[model samples]
Target: MKKWKLGMIVAAAALSVVALAGCTAGKSSSGADDKNVTMWVHFSKEDPEGKAMVQNITAFNKENKKGYKATVQYIPRSGSGGGYEDKINAALNSNSLPDVLTLDGPNTAAYADSKIIQPLGKYITKKSDILPSIIDQGTYKGKLYAVGYSESGVGFYYNKKMFKDAGITEAELPTLDKPWTWDQFNAILKKLTEKYQGPAIDMQLSDHSEMAIYSLAPFVWSAGGNITNKAGTKAVGYFDSAATQSAFKEIQDMVKNGYTTISPKQKGFQTGKYAMLMSGSWTIQELDKQYKDISYGILPYPVSPKTKKLVSPTGSWQYAMSASTTKTAASGALIDFLSAKAQMYRTSMANTVLPARKSVSDEMMSKVTEPMRFLIKQNQESGHARPVLVKYPQVSRTFAETVTKATYYKENPDISALMKKQAQEIQQYLK
Candidate 1:
């Protein structure tokens, strides 16, 4: 991954300390004498779903009659890790980490490697029914250290009205069973561009050239190429291979040929300007609010022309217990509660994220709207999580940067040179 500018890293590190200091003022509910279990959560307390989670925790506390109660501290939603990383790092340095906390997928491995988090192996025995992929995402160095709360994946969001106006039927929109291949996807984009006078597609990468790499991950993975190897010690070399080059060239052609537009100020997919976009299931809530009349649906990202199978990037949030916590049983119990059958069901009701448990997801599918049901099904079958590694964030950033430079540079954007540089950087870091 690309290295952050020294200044940005220093600034983020400094801000993190201040953020943690600010959070220390909040009073704990577990009482001064009673052992307290603190939770670091990323969700905004002001959001209705976040409020519901607080209410649920309260209800759980009352019903369980556990002597110890928990207190949640909200992390600000700025910087990478949504400001939670800084708080976590501060807590780690001071050895004051909360009993439990939420972790981004990539960060889980890093924290686990640092030995600041406890492995959840014992706690997970009873919850063995959780999906293997979800469980795997929280594992690092052969130990299960975190429990996933929700699972998300990237997919294509198309405007149904645009399809209809183009005389493209619902049958034409790619589905799980009938996913679109690169050639087919390109054809569809071409058709949409020809039929619609507005912006055909919005890629949302204009300023930070590296940002497009995240948007193109599905394509790379679908093509059986990856930004990095499984072990995460080196960058993948296939990025400049003929197949991968052709795949990226298609994206460039889409932009240059008017089939796609790269914009910084564009609105969501619900707007008529773009017929389709690459996004995760998290957008369902906003889409429901913004485009009630337009029929929109999601499908797994199209497969690469070189590879026939569709692949989608896994996006998830994990719950982990802090190593410093004295109340292991209490914190473990809370993790169990979150992963329990009934509470897992609440994951869907309260936060639109897919449950970590398949059973809960099955039930959630039955209750949620049609579009969301499709999203859940796609997420279950095709989602691919980011690899767990200590240097994942850095690796991800590097990969994003390399792809962006290749796509936006005026002169020859030597993909081979970029890949070699990335590999050397990762190798040095690992050593």
Candidate 2:
């Protein structure tokens, strides 16, 4: 969401928010038994993803394994406008956190650091089956605190018709074996801008929360810089590094050269307002469904000009148990059941997300649609989770706000100075 969106959520959530509603009896109701494991899942019950999960839980409950009764408490899409964070914080403070819950990819660290969730590694033994990036997304300070059943990935999507019109051949486009260097990519953006009267690429710059962090961090990664250092301790040299500066400079250049606007366009690529886009795999489904007339192609993220490395973003929603929940056995059982190979395939297939487990992903490749298979393959090979740090929220918000500030004005930011300021701000939140 955009900062305004988040701001509205936080401000409104300050009054009343529905973090969890309906059958939230997981917090040890009067007659609740040990078999009652409840989940506070964020998906709207009206959506297909939510409906499918509810159905899965219903089926699981039908089994009555050990007489367990699994239930779901629908968490609103955006609670009181603060989104998930505010709702969750309220729930935690009220001592009403659900026994099992789902968290976005980058939030594991925040919740773990706050002691809202517990380490889950001991509950599952088949961690090897899960993608390393998926595991990394859920880990905090070396301990696994969460695990996702499915994954999400991002790629550079292009308008094939625009490419053809610009005299760009398939060979010129970056391939997995040969991603475009930063220079090559900038040159192409320039060409696209000159050839197309509209934007060259859709940065989706308007939304500044998860979208900002998920899409932009990879560029920093490709440049061999990070939101935080390797030890996950500091952002000083990393966020303010020369490589990181160079990366953002290119982004600023794209804006300065009229290749992309500082704000997201309304269906820019789909409507031919933009020639390219950096988007999630789910976009393929949206395009196919909402804009079947448009011809588009997907490619790996551009590599760093200096490092020649590709780091594609990966992480979606994952389930984590509440640290204070007493029903470990039942809650763990529900989590394991959710992440089971068959269940992963089922839910991921229904949701169009990549399965986290290799076995489930392979099965999906063989059985799911071509686009789904393609995304699964990319996720398996090139996926990289966001920096799992306790202060990820601050880091993400700072970097996003910095990027926006850099592009908001006609003049670009002083890279080192702005980055240092951002790094310093993030440093203050390290403890």
Q: Would you list the C-alpha lDDT of every candidate in the order shown?
A: 0.70, 0.81
Off by over 4 Å in 2: 1-32, 63-65, 79-87, 408-410
Local error of candidate 1 at 44, Å?
3.6
The Cα error of candidate 2 at residue 161, in Å, is: 1.2
Model 2's TM-score against the true structure: 0.88
lDDT of 1 by residue, 1-431 (tens): 23568778889999999898877644332335444577888877877557766876786677666675777787755754447777667666556777888887777877887777888778654566677667778888778888887777656788877788888886776778878887777788888888876556666556353235445766666777665566666553544445555556666666656766656336646666778877766778878887677677776677876667766666577789987776787888777776676776776677777767788887887789876787777777777666676876676766566555555545435545655565566555442
lDDT of 1: 0.70
Q: Write one digit per residue (lDDT tens) for candidate 2, span 1-431.
A: 59999999887786444444433322432235777877888778888788788878987898645877888987766643455566677676567777899888888888898898998788775789999998988988789999987888888888999898998888898877788987898888888888987678998877777788888888888888777777777878878889888778777777777888876578888887788988898898899899998888787788887888877888888999998788888888888888888778878888888889999987877777666666777788888998887777777888888788667546545767877888888888775
User: Could you tell me every candidate's TM-score relative to the true structure?
Assistant: 0.83, 0.88
Q: Clashing residue pairs, candidate 1?
A: 1-394, 1-395, 1-398, 2-397, 2-398, 314-384
